[model samples]
Target chain A: MLPVRRSILGLMDRLMSFHRGSLWVGVVLVVIAPLSVALLLSMWRSPFPINEMISLLEDAESSTPGRFFDPTIRSWYRPLFHLTLWGFWNGSGSLLGGLHWFRYLEVGSVLVLLLLFVSYLRPRTGLQAAAALLAVAVMMGMPGFRDNLEIPVLMTLVGMPMALLVWMLLEREHRWWYTPLILALTMTAIGYKEQGLVIAPVVVGAWWMGSPGARRTTTAVVVLAVLAYLAMRFSTRGHWALFEQDVGFLFGELGEDEAAARFGERPWILYGYSALATIGNILFSEPSRGTFVITDHALSGETRPWEWISIVSSTLMTALIAWWGVAILRRDWSADAWSAESRLFVILVLALGASGALGFNYARDRLGGMAVPFYAAASYFAVLSVAERAGAASLKRRATVALVLVMLAGAWQLRAVGTLHDVRLRAASTHRTWITSPNWSRVTFAHRPRYLSIMQTMTPQGTDPARARRPTYPEWFLALIGGG
Target chain B: MPAGNTRILAWLIAMPALLCAVGLPLYESSDVAQPPAMADTFVEALDDRNVEHAYLFIRQGQDPNTLVRFRDDVRTGGREVQVSPLMLAVAGSDDNTAAMLLSFGARMDYPPNRYVVCLAREMGMDGFVDSQMSTASEVECPPPSGAEFPLLAYVD
Candidate 1:
């Protein structure tokens, strides 16, 4: 009994002890969490060719490759986005297969974020690992992540952040040729979404902090990139608007013209409110229904049973980060205090602010998608810095208790996300509200009658007209597990 | 700094520019042809109560589930309302038109409320509503909230 006890203690001590190699253990945990959740939750069973997804595919099928580059064809110009739709349609062999590929890509982008966290922070202790795990759980709990998972059109949610992280990771090593490489990334990010410009300031800030010799070249490259991005984006003279004007139309309260007139009266005040509400939504889990309205949701209601879990966990984690920030400011004023981790936390906080600022017309959880990953990284780093400063002997005692509590919080949040995801999946499977919802009607092609013709004829490539059906999860689960 | 980095750098610079040069012209020079004018005629057929013409339009790739906005001048004080073909058919008590739509995978749950079923029952189309609402025990009707008839729900 004594020998067993001694061995267990030794194992615990070794895990708690700081080492560079142990960071890889955290990396492994990060990788496993998303993959396991995706599989267990049966995320790939999403309904395809519904809502805007149907129109996107139909447009992809109808349009020539060159039409994607033509700014006059669409209200917004995102050639890469258009091309991605084309690629997804042609490459996947079927509409069902296309949905599967899209799910994989979304999951893959999120995994890139997880790996980026590991690469950036290099968390060393088991407590740091738990913190990262908790951060990921919180990310999944976020309404933005939930919205993106259900709606593939919001690829920019994860794509924009992934682009930012990739640029940040590369910009650290300032070789002469890296300038063009950064330029390419910038262009591609813009090609993905216009909000890709949001990443520019953070990248420039990072470059400014680096070696003085490289600063001039870095600044020149970023400036040139920004100029080029602006020229390319605006030169075509596509339908350009700073904000979505159809607010009342969105809420089903007023006509489009009436809504436009109302919003135009005090656009600045409305935009400011949208931005702040979005930021508040991301940090404290406060519901913002100004832009994306979710009906019959816990987030929208006054308060519900499990709503407290998301609110409490998110608020607690943010408060801890704030506490850590103050402690760092007071105690560690040296050059080392503004280390890579600290600098990144500051940059991400800026990026979160920028993301809110980009919520130009209205506040929606989906707009916070780019910031959520950064927020997660900030949470991870704060917990890591706190644990590192605490020393191992003291931390080991407190970490165990914290670890258990974090695990419980993480499980509760993940369960909430799963329940919500299941609800979306059920709706998607039925082919009812998923296609006919007012939110979907807001999409560019939803109202077009010609496109509606194309939508009805489309099916999984090999499916017979009689047998072509979107199977609900129970049907899939029964077949797999119960041998139905 | 490294040989591999230089090779990657070359590819990174060349690919996007090349893609834009080759891809842009192809997109800019070409335009997508419009789809055949089928839906307008289909809507017209439904409006005229020409079940045969509507069936022909459905066969010619007109989706029965398509919701087209029309002026409800007499019914709703001149407000435009979006209605599916099935709803139009039900409102007119055109059983053949309704049956044809249902046969071609038109969903009965398109109506925002249970008022459509109430309308069908009033029209003596109990068999059609019964077949569509097989799962529900009964159609629970609620009082209409607005001044206009509930079936012609307002649209912006």
Candidate 2:
């Protein structure tokens, strides 16, 4: 019995030592697994309009920078996103091909984010391998990633990695070119989405949390880039803050008047609920779940009991993770335990808060960039805590706990895999129904005809009409329409 | 890992959940006006040139004369109509009773394109119906005038 116990302890120590060897393998698995799932799911035809591609192509073809900022023509000033899309569309020569390129880009962004995270954790001891893998899995499994595959959402996703890269770069060497490069990246990120402005605050926050240096350098760079962004935005959109124009759509018929009324009736209370709900949606909701409902009446009878169970369980887990994050922040700040990981947690928390404040409703896609830091912090602390406890425990007890955690992680991975498979099945069915439908007049269950009408108006006549059609109508649609 | 730390962690987690639980119901139940799904359907149908389908979605019980006027106004218009679902939802108060002031796009003959669609519940009816239509700038149902039946609105 004594010999057996000694051997097991020796084996556990050996396994711990071997984690370095497994790091690359773990990184590859973490990056590839979700991307493979995404690729498989991509086989289904998208019902969403290729409005972004069409708009970019038109902008490029017309050679009009005016339209880029024109409030009536374009809703927002995202020049970098427009240019990137233009390049993709020009290169691909087809809308579908451009969309496929976006999927690849999205996967690549996820890889970059994972690589950055893994590189940060590689130097840390103990269960960081487990934590890194778990973080990646959690991030990939999020509904936000799935929702962000759509064109508009993909634009925001592009900005996320750019912002993260800027943050990473800022923490390291400060060459003369670094400021210009950081400024350029920051501006480009903003051009992708207004949410990119959150990067400025994140950089500033990170600098504040960072070791004391010429703070003025970081501050000046961020402020200058922001001013430049504002100048460009104002020049193009005729306003410094154009997000309000977009928010008007959320008010429905009442527009700003409804917002005013809601504000009058306890502004803080309304916003507070919005923030909490947004966080909840970010952490708890799965990609395979049905649309989020704000009102009690909107709850569907079809929602399974386990769906409710999953929500509650996820909520509890999220709360615990968040609590742990708060503890880490408190401990680290007080102890002056300033590391890249700690600074990242600070950035994510701020970003999450900023995201909640900017948007009125809970949209999983909007939370995509913010969620990365959250999962990272949660996983890091979880592993650290487990490692700490395991180090102090008996070998038999350590093995039992480690085995249980592995089993839980396995279950999570399997659940994510199962959800993706389910999504693929649904997407395939929806795609088939979308293509086979004869009457374009009536809205099918799988497709919204309203969007199709909008797309027809947006696409230039020179572009193939079939490409603009929903479910991207195959050649059969042209035949059915007598090549109209 | 100490008992004190565990208690502090518990409090930290509990506080947010507690606040959310207390605040969410209050926020949702607050009186904010929003248009019903039926209004969205009606406007969409009108946009699609399916006036009959639009009319079908309107809950019945309006002054016969008023109904005729609305039907004629929608059918004869060369003017474009765009229905924003968010606008419809935001314009009306809770309790299925609400009014929407719609803007009509310029036509060859018409200079101003503004109409009001008022929805209210009839006595003992389960659902709210489109009770009135007017070209008047201001129309209110279940308010100071109290001429229209009050019905519970659907919250989306």
lDDT of each candidate versus the true structure: 0.56, 0.46
Candidate 2 lDDT over residue span A1-484, tens digit each:
9999999999998887667546544643544443343433342333333444344455565555445544445545566666666566567986556655755675676556656655555533323444555555455445455455443356667766676667667777666666677777677777777767767777778678762331568668888779776676566554332113212222122234454465646655544545554555566753221234322222535544334433543554466466666767787888877765566666667776766664443233454454554454465555456545655677687666555545434434433333343444334433323222212212221154444443454333212222222222235322221112
Give lDDT: candidate 2, residue A407: 40
Clashes of each: 3, 15
After superposition, candidate 1 runs with Cα above 4 Å error:
A1-31, A34-41, A90-104, A158-161, A167-172, A175-177, A211-215, A232-258, A291-302, A329-333, A388-408, A419-430, A433-453, A460-484, B1-156
- For candidate 1, what is the TM-score? 0.62
The alpha-carbon deviation from the true structure for residue A267 of candidate 2, after best TM-score superposition, in angstroms, is: 7.0
TM-score on 0 to 1 scale for chain A of candidate 1:
0.74
| TM-score of each candidate structure, all chains considered together | 0.62, 0.55
Candidate 1 DockQ, CA atoms: 0.03
Tell me how each candidate scores on DockQ against the true complex: 0.03, 0.02
Candidate 2 ranges beyond 4 A from true positions: A1-66, A70-75, A91-103, A123-126, A173-176, A211-215, A231-273, A284-313, A361-364, A393-411, A418-484, B1-156
lDDT of 1 at B113: 28
